[model samples]
Target: MSEPLVVPEVRRLGPARLTAGMDRWDRLDFAAHRRTHGPLPRASRSELLAVADRIDLRGRGGAAFPFARKARATLGAAERSGRAPVLVVNGAEGEPPSVKDATLLARAPHLVLDGVTLAALAFGAAEVVVAVASGSAAELSVPAAIAERGRDPVPMRTLCVPDRFVSGESGALIRAVNGRAALPPSRPVRAAEGGRGGVSGRPTLLCNAETWAQLALAARLGPDAFAVVGTPDEPGTLLVTVNRSPRPPVVVEVPAGASLAVVLDACGVDPGAGVLVGGYHGAWLPPHLAPDLPLSRTGLAAAGGTLGAASVVALPRGVCALAEITAVAGWLADESTGQCGPCRRGLPETVDALRALSRGAGSASAVRRAAALGRGRGACAHPDGVARFVLSALTVFAEDIATHASGSGCGLSSGLTLPLPRQAGERLAVDWARCAGHGLCASLAPDLITLDPHGFPLLRENANLAPWQRPQARRAVARCPALALRIGR
Candidate 1:
């Protein structure tokens, strides 16, 4: 694979929390980590819960779920059911634009491991798992950190899985670790509830890589000290990935209530155009609002966006907003798991509609219909997220849409600025040169395979079958009388 056009740099603002000592390039070995951050603070289960409640630390992952509540529930479930709880440090870093988790694992692996060890001690877990995306730098860094620790009370292990977009979801991670397909299950179940019998049928305490780091810091600093830097409701530092056009992105740790504009400026990003906060699944906000908005979740929520994964992609001038949206929409459609009807069908339809609008041949009604078809209809949030992103693009760039719809092009060519995965999922293929067009594949997996005008089987556009869909797709391939159907990467 070609190297990324823009690689992200890492830094810290105010006092560093998880990013301490990152600038030195020295791996915080076990001794150094202890010296820098004090001894690994030990806390009882109740004390850990109390500290989490007081600090109001939320998961650093995109969900931003309350950490205290999740911890309490997981502990409660384990106790009630008499099942041991397993601690999982999720360093999958599935979102292409985000780099905080990988940064932590690379520069300060011991801090993260300390956090995991602390959590395991609190939960009385016999084993702890640190899951990194396969082939990531963290895949090597984390295991080395574990080996550096030698023997511990709770054994720690590292597991690497394929780096797909949805594979980082909590349920999907659990499912993947349990030797199942790394796709979200049809039925929603919390890992804390012993969902799908997580990692040997035990209750799981899953937290984002940064969340574990924060817990370790909070245990060392106590609630009041941690609250000194951030807001009242949400206190502590945030790791933000800033992607400015024409420049590589950078990950910076800033206080929660820091001014968004200041953070962007410090990262040398020109927010004069618009900004896509969070990752691709997050919202687009007007650049003018950056100065006044706080970096906290509540503040971003009031501004009609989220601090999702704390990723900020600056939209530069001279690019057509509609064109950019079209590119991102097409990418999202291709990334869908294809398990649910809404995502499999609605996302591609939405992409086509957006493309039509960019060419001045589509109506707003068509785009709206496509968005509605996908919203709230999928087993996972993939469809809903796509709908939200597309709808927001339509609303935020209404003037641009109007101009494009009137046949006056936005005067800019489509240059995709957002980062997407370099590798695409495997797609279904047909051997048209070898055999007759029987259309058996279409009959076997109608959702994934469709009939072309020539009665030959054509894999549906953007139809990258999910784990659940593979069975039928394989069946269709096997049943092809002409021996023409196959899957290709």
Candidate 2:
């Protein structure tokens, strides 16, 4: 038997975090962190840009855009004299299968904080906000870490937001911090505009928390030292969330040039099945064919996939892939912030069609409906991504889909072991007995609640909208004569 790689227990911390502020914690001592991975001497903006350019450091936040280039683009806007940029460290791990961000926030909060403060210093930003999902463990843990780091006195704040997925997007977080609804705007405005409204209406620089942590690492290592491990174009190790059977969840930093085979072996992944690369917005690949592929942006890009927020999910045999996709489609529809019309109405419609396809109840018309409804009507990539995920699943699993569509046997009853988002904690629920079907709740808060065919209230999606809508949605919550609706935030 081939030996399986033992997935290490990831603390995600550079030496400093392991030491807890270069200080002592309980019986454990981490003073060596600063000695080994001490902060780099502050770099001038030009020198910082040079360091970024040397390593070709790209945003690890899925887009992977060149960091130096993005800095140049945003820096010019930030130089508007006394209107320093707003640096936002995005800690909201919205992808259900992705625990890397939350893991880092919990285990290596200082590493992330180090990156945030470094960027703020580099950008001369007046304000910094580390946004995490409200009510999540991050809400508490991140704040605690920041307070503990008071030893290093950095200008920073924390904004706990609702756990809605789309709200984690860069622009949406900006809008939410500005007291607007936590939904993507209808227009694609670059955040550099820093127009009047939120966060002092200043130029904003947003990046994933992991990306910042890497930046902190890059600063210390310098570009050449950083290039020692990973590929030429993509230097340094990256954090990946590996999900396969038998192995517990792990967050590991594999060199960029490492083979996919090494990663699989490290994670104890079994020989062959479908691999969900990237997150839901990413593509799926079969295992036997994918193992030899290099584990870099260029490598995955060559094969029509992206190394998204670093979520890799391996699906075993016997589980119905079609049914799994269907359930996720439902969850994706429910996750939308529902500020856009196409995403608001279209995602659920797409889910309805996929559900029909799962039950083998829909005709060619149903397939057409699914394809037509959610192609590109959303403000962000949410709707388009859902369409892509479903369409790809249908194409890849045509054999299984045919088995169901023919009303024969797909032989699976929605065995949803393939990881996806699920509702956690208390959420809004309606008492069916008390429902009068007046449709008032749907009308009063159309963005959140909608009326189904039975005139019963159906949740459009999870969100904590603008302050006014909060009260309005709350009023609708109380005004229901049947007292069936209750809002839980």
Candidate 3:
């Protein structure tokens, strides 16, 4: 049986942006939302853009791109191309360490839907799509919220995309929406440029679920009121998922310039241990590095990290840093889309090297070499992100690496404190005992299969195929003459 999904407790500190009314026992339905927070104010596209610029609102997604700039660019592209744009609300919280999006979606679904409606009206969009991961709490909550509204000015719908790590990426999400494999394209193309035939197959105004919720609040509160609590550069409350502590992980809404030390303490975590700021694709910082830094993107960047998705994972004192990093690296390797040679080849090798180093059997040079091979060489940022994460681990735990390299390693711990999911999709196995080496699988599905030193097919560690790739994978399975390959969930 599947484990019961634990809904994280919600805590609001400082001024609330997207997380207002979350303390109430009842879910904030449409009527209660309007009664509690007032109606969402309408504004012209240019006016909304001006407010966004004034507030310096950035995407709550990992990238932290300026929301005003994105809106203006997408609107400009729509006008130039004479095509209607589509507004997408991205609620796919695929990052295992982050639960802020899910918290907001489950507790305050109307707020998000209100933001979607306001954005659609501002962009003059005829259709809006709320995209969530299949079987996620947001998948059910969003549609119910939409139904509660009775009628919307623009038609709005919800779609469930594959829940892979890269699948939530903007390019991959767009590809999935366009009926293709949920993988990023080799070339960089903005969704704004090509209109209906572009990267998203439309001039799409796709923003994070939290970003939309922020927009909804911004519309109601206006710029001055919205800018009251946060720092000048990053003004507003940010929802952060705090984990790796003794207490259950909670999603807290904190002001932009709040002290990281205080936030960690509030989340029932010791502030003296190392912290993984941002999600898996982010960096690690010593306890001292975070105390003085504000929780804003600029502050975190100044302290050698980005506030990506506002996920703060406090490393416990006794946990093995090297083992934690190794497990995360292995999970990331398995999550790769296998669309690029660098990601497909370098990540697994990096995982292997890290595993060996964790066990005190491998050289640090091997880990570094494998990590370097992945930098800046993939269709998407997957390889670059993995490289950054691994390199950061090496740098932050240099002493650990040295000690482990000497062959007197830290003993393996019985449990993992890291937040990787227990189950990461399905597995593709090759029965090495059953058949002779054959290269047919590699040729049939090069993107999913590779050849090792002995010419045996090296199936990707996780056999989770995107919806569009299933038919080709099935064909490859059918043609395997040795009948030595099988898939298991």
Steric clashes per prediction: 0, 2, 0
Measured by lDDT, the strongest candidate is: 1
lDDT for model 2: 0.69
Stretches of candidate 3 off by over 4 Å are 1-6, 195-200, 245-247, 412-414, 424-489
Which of candidates 1 and 2 is the stronger one according to TM-score?
Answer: 1
Q: Runs in model 2 with CA error above 4 Å?
A: 1-8, 11-32, 135-137, 151-154, 196-198, 245-248, 363-373, 421-489
Across residues 1-489, which tens digit of lDDT does each residue of candidate 3 receive?
Answer: 123334788887886657777666336778778877887788888888888888888889899888888888887888887877888888886878888887787778888888878878888986888888887877777778888888899998888887778878887787777778767776666876654335445688888899988888888888899988988888879998989455568889999889988888787788444788888889888877766978888888887887888898876766678888887887887677667777767887788788777667887888999999968778888888888778887888677778788889866452678787777455556778865777888888776788989998876543455443455577777788888776656
Colliding residue pairs in candidate 1: none
Ranking by lDDT: 1, 3, 2
**Shift of residue 420 alpha carbon in model 1, Å:** 1.3
Q: After superposition, how far is residue 256 of candidate 3 from its true place, in Å?
A: 0.4
Q: Which candidate has the highest TM-score of all?
A: 1
Query: What is the C-alpha lDDT profile of model 1 across 132-181, one tens digit per residue?
Result: 88878787778878888889889888988788778787878888878887
Candidate 2: RMSD to truth = 6.3
- Cα lDDT computed for each candidate against the true fold: 0.80, 0.69, 0.78
User: TM-score per candidate, in order?
Assistant: 0.90, 0.81, 0.89
RMSD of each: 3.6, 6.3, 3.7
Q: What is candidate 2's lDDT per residue for 193-297, written digit by digit as tens?
A: 577423567877788888887888888777787777777788788887777644457666677757776776776776354777788877776666566777788
